[model samples]
Target: MASITSSGLGSGLNVNDIISQLMEIESQPLTKLQDKAKEAQAKISAIGTLQGALSTFQGRVLSLSSASAYKSLKGSLADTTIGTVSTAVNAQAGSYSLAVTQLAQAHKLKSQSFSSVNAPVGTGSMTIQFGTYDDKGTSGNAADDTFEVNGDKGALTIEIDSTNNTLTGLRDAINAKKAGVTATIVNDGSGYRLLLSSSDSGKANSLKITTDDADGNDTDTAGLSRFSYDPLGTKNLTQTQAAQNAEFQLDGIAISKSSNTVTDVLQGVTLTLQKVSARDTNNAPVATSLNISRDTSGVKTAVEDFVKSYNEFVKSVEGLSFYNKDDNSAGLLNGDYVIRSMQSSIRSTLNQGLGSGSYYQSLGAVGVSFDDKGNMTLDSTKLQKALDTRPEDVASLFAVNGVTSDARVSYVSSTAATQVGSFGVSISSPATRGNFSGLAVANGPITIAEGDNDMLMVAVDGASSGQIKLSPGSYATPAALAAEIQSKINGDSRLKDANAAVTVSYNATSGKFEMSSNKYGAKSNVQITATGSATEATLGFKVAQGGTGSDVVGTINGEPAKGDGQVLTGSGKAEGLKLTITGDTAGEYGTIGFSRGFASKLDQTVTSMLSDNGLLRSRIDGLNRDLKNIGAQGNTVTRRLEDIEKRYRAQFTALDVQIATMNSTSTYLSQQLSMLNNLASGNKK
Candidate 1:
């Protein structure tokens, strides 16, 4: 047995006990800190919850405010304008308009036909497929074949009553023929009849007849029942140039053209001629001469027609609700008014000095408005007064882009006019500092609408992030511009590219941006902006603009972005922006864009706040390792203390027992010795 030593203890405290006490102190503090952190997190989360709710609410209300139905249209017509519009409005500021003053009409080809291709021997039935067939105008039974008629060569049983052929019937039959020719007959009762005619003028609308006589006769001679069979073919009228004329008056000044489709005649209106096919309720041809010729009466009729059309357009526009003010949805004439306004105003005359813009305020002055029915209406009397009193002012009210209407609808004025063809431009990226256009942007040749609102979205970079830019441009013909897009972009490397670092591509159909990454790096981003036809400084249009910086969303911070910056379909890309441009009398140049791409640059922002090598996770890992070390040291010390305590306790118990045994032995020995001494003493006594 061994005795334990107190020397191992200091100040009466065991090393094991002291180590345990230190661990308890450290653990309690850590627990308190954790609880405090969790409480603070809860508070922060509450603030975020409230903010998110308010953001959603505000966004919803603002969206309601911007709906198109809430706005009204107002503007006046002028000599500087075209079409029948007394006035137009700014409802569809960024959209396109197409006023078909004169549309290309299909020509009419009329004729008479036979039942069989080979009208053999007059015993066959007669058929008249009017209007057109197989390139020739005449179809059905021939006039000489319909009735018995004698020709120099032969005779047939069928012949057309040449004297009784009605132009109305002939016209219908010709139209049915679909032969591509127009046919009609004219009569004034001078003993003349069967005046066969075609729908088209010139040789394109010619009449051809086939004839065969019964009994193997070469000429059908029996078809002259209603016709005066003339061997010389005197009744066959040649289809020369149709006398149908295009004529109309502007401000009481008469204008005329031989073609039904007249261009650049009025400032902005194109006139088309359509012969009246149906008579009045009387079911008869207009007693008036088949006057295809342009005359003062024709001019008056054109004016009256224009007035009626203009009024009708107004009525329709006012009737359609785009937004319901009360319900905050669509209204009476809500969505439809804008479209109506666009179509009607596309070719309307603009003001003369509308270039000044301040005086050419709106369409209300010339008399355009959404009547109670939500339909568009025009004030003829007011329009006439404006035209009569301030002809120049009226001109200023309707026609502003140029001296003529064609100049505004088209952009091919001078070489200096913003060349409306394929244009290319690239914007620099703000995030990557590397040129992204070289890698990602697609080669471009995008189509531009003749009017505004058609936006072109341009991207800055495609790698980590990209910017979106909205631009509105125009082209004379989408196809021609598309063909020249890549060439233009390649030719003008400066305008089309950024430091020769970006490739370009434009989807004429989609009109969007495509970017690719060529550079290598970490930090990448893009900035977006919008431009419109009205915004071009050269257009001279009374242009107002917005949405240049409203783009708040960006993506692809450290990931792939495939032109994700897309516009919502119904939400029209440029719908949020407003544009008012004074068109260029010299010409209007539409807007276009270029896409620039950039590669990723090294991005260390995540670890920048802390040590480059130690992020929050690393620090947490380090703490865990330290905790393990502390635990290991504490555990080792604990095990050693336990062994020492056990050994000492055993030693102390044995020592105590041995000491007691020694005392007992000493007591017993002393007793025995005392007895022996007593005995000896007794013996000696």
Candidate 2:
């Protein structure tokens, strides 16, 4: 019988267990690599957390980097029912008595009653003009009214064909144009009628519609002529409400405005008229008190928010790099240089002084400071004192600010490239506007005939005005003629669309009519390109070119700067500094002192730390590279461990087999010897 024995049983040793123990010992390096990779991943996640906190803190810092935030103004009224008031940054603190006598109203007109909304109203074309109507000499009759077209509003022409001959079609067509007038149909129990109203609430926005009926009779109350509302001729539409100005009393002075919302009367103050003031026993308008004052609550809130956000950020940093001495544990980024550097940079910026020649130079001057624990604290009382006494200085201490000595040389803007220092401003030549000087008139009152001296073409600021038509009337003086020309030129649709306008003035000394562009630059110019047949005879204006405008020549910090319109941009060390020169004199204006404040500096630092190639990104990229290397090494060690385990298994199996073979041989020999001994003993017996 053949004896079958397992290799481990014959050797009296467990081969599987021995091989497992050896393999475990050999993979120590790979295990250490895996632990290192996990640490790297944890550190990367910690950095991401730090970046998120920094970003949240940066948003609060940016709020204090502009001067407008600190220039808030508040308005209050003793009687809120009278009207509402709003104020701008430039508004002065004062008290005023206001009395609203009238509210501006838009003009409304209605056509004669019709049978239905779809009633037929034959059509050809209709032209709508916006203007002011003068009823000074007329009683209540509409035929004696005088209308003067508003130069600021251009006349709009609309075509009416058979497709839109009905009242509803005409209403829809007029609405589609958005031509400063709204049309609707109304039923007054007797019949339906077409109602039209001006889009704006001002005396100068009244509508005057004229039509050319397809039936060849335009003034008759038939066809499209029924909608005509020319004050001089047809009067088919009846005026229900006339456009009027708003009348009010400010500090005992009577004031009138074209709109109910008055802005220009008060400096930086806007008043919206709601209702007429209550009348007293004597039929006089009652007065309401309006008070304007500086608002400081917004600045205080901004400072508080900044301090809270900054303290929270500091706490986050400390927590990320914390170390537990008692427990013998460490945070993921226990000794990170990048995190430490970021905190240090921000702290240094906050501590730096702003050399802006302001009363307040640093955050400490406005009662913001850091404690021993690196947490920011705000002194509310002290901050309020500074804001109340030196508000502009406090604003300059937290924003990128510029101060000019001359009021005419105002600081427009500056860029990051602009250096923080005083720069000398010297203007060699001031800006000039382009102008056209027409020939002098022969005698007095110029007569503008229809179709004779009415049409002309003009170009303003290099933008052409196509076929501008002048209103036919009699001018008493050169000033009146100048006003008429200015009105006609500015009312051109082509020039208005291009944002180009002109101011026509009568030069009494030169005895000439001058038309100048409203813009001031090298491209600012006005030219009369074409004229009517009698234009030269009546208006004394022939086809002529105006003088070209010249740009402003100046130097900033002794370096030649670029000029466009009224803006002058500096170069060299003063690069990106924009200044507006409004003075006509050509000489040294003054120096502009500039500085970058704490909030601006700190914002820049945090922005740099969080950019794509910033500190956190670089560190994360390096840790990722280390993780990849560790993974590669782990793969290599795993391959080597597989070979080592195979070799160990093979050697142990061979030793077991050899031991089994030896044991079997010894047993066989012993058995043979025993048999021989037994036989010899039997022979001996």
Say which candidate scores most in TM-score: 2
Estimate, for each residue in 1-685, the C-alpha lDDT of model 2 and write its tens digit: 3443454866889878888888889989998999999999999999999999999999999998887777778887788988799998778788999998999999899999999988998989877778777886648676566666665565666678989999999899888767588999999999999999998888888888888799999889999999999766668999999899999999999998888888998788999898999999999999999898889999999999999999999888888888989997877788888877887788788777666345477788888988888789999999999887767667778877777788789788889898877789999998888877888775467778879998889888889988876666676666766666776677566887898998877788787888889899898988889999999777667887576787788999899999997889999988999999998879998988777877888889888888888888899999999999999999999999999987987787778778878998999999999999999999999
TM-score of each predicted structure versus truth: 0.20, 0.92
Local distance difference test, each candidate: 0.31, 0.84
Off by over 4 Å in 1: 1-27, 61-70, 73-685
Give per-residue lDDT, candidate 2, residue 544.
76
Off by over 4 Å in 2: 1-10, 116-120, 137-146, 162-165, 176-179, 212-217, 324-328, 357-359, 442-444, 473-488, 505-511
